[model samples]
Target: MAKIMLVDDAAFMRMMLKKALTESGYTDFVEAQDGAEAVKKYGEENPDLVIMDITMPNMDGLQALKKIRESDPDAKVVMCTAMGQEAMVVEAIKSGAKDFVVKPFNGERIVQTVSSILGK
Candidate 1:
């Protein structure tokens, strides 16, 4: 079981993601509401993977990505994005995100993305 960090500004999004992850046989995880919290939780929790939203308050995903990468060069981060954020996706990839998933939440694809990243 891979430990994951789910980071999104919306509580609903976090809940949905947690459900999907649980259904996919991922039992361990931590949650963060925004990039700042993500950075803090990541340092403490050291999850195996992170699913992050690009647009958030108190620091966006890209900045958090950079910070996490700086702290852990091998960090595995998958970005969650809304439509019309192609530029942000590209930037995230450049910043060391391993993959991306678009939302309003596709459960199967999210599971697949996580599985593929973890090579499961």
Candidate 2:
């Protein structure tokens, strides 16, 4: 069972993601509402994978990604970005994010990304 972290400002998005992943047979989950919380929780939960939104209050995904990767070089983070954020996605990739997903969350894409990353 891979431990996964879901980080997004919107509670609905997190819930949706959790629901989708659970239905797909993923059980373990940790959630945070913003990048700041995510950074703090990363150390505590040490999840196998993270699905994080790019635009968030108090630190943003790119910053959090850097900090997490700094602490754990092997950390696997998948960024969630909106359309037209290709520049940030490039930066995210350069900063060590394992992959990315676009917002308005697609259940199938999210599941596929998670499965590929965790090899589940």
Candidate 3:
């Protein structure tokens, strides 16, 4: 069982990702409402994967990814981005995100991304 962290400022977004991940047979999720919390939780929980929203308060996903990468070079992060955030997406990739999923993503796509990243 993989431990995953879900980071999003919106409670609804976190809930949606949680529901999708649960349905895809993933358990042990840790949720964060912002990038600051995401970094803290990453240290505490050390989740196998992090699914983080790009636009978050306190710190954006790119910053959090950078911080996490600095601490753990092998961190597996899957950034969540909305439409028209191409530059940020490129930055995320440069910052070391393993992959990304666009907003309005389907459950199947999320599952596929996670499974592929985790080699499940």
The local lDDT score (0 to 100) that residue 17 gets in candidate 2 is 93
> What is candidate 1's lDDT per residue for 42-114, written digit by digit as tens?
9999999999999999999999999999999999999999988999999999999999998887999999999
In terms of lDDT, model 1 sits at 0.95
Worst 10 residues of 3 by lDDT: 104-113
| lDDT for each candidate structure | 0.95, 0.95, 0.94
Estimate the overall C-alpha local distance difference test score of candidate 2.
0.95
Candidates' RMSD to native: 0.7, 0.7, 0.6
TM-score against truth, every candidate: 0.97, 0.97, 0.98
Rank candidates, lDDT, best first: 2, 1, 3
- Superposed model 3: Cα runs more than 4 Å off: none
Tens-digit lDDT string for candidate 2 (1-120) = 999999999999999999999999999999999999999999999999999999999999999999999999999999999999999999999999999998887899999999998887
* Per-residue lDDT of candidate 3, residues 76-106 (tens digit): 9999999999999999998999999999888
Native RMSD of candidate 1 (Å): 0.7
Query: Quick one: best TM-score, which candidate?
Result: 3
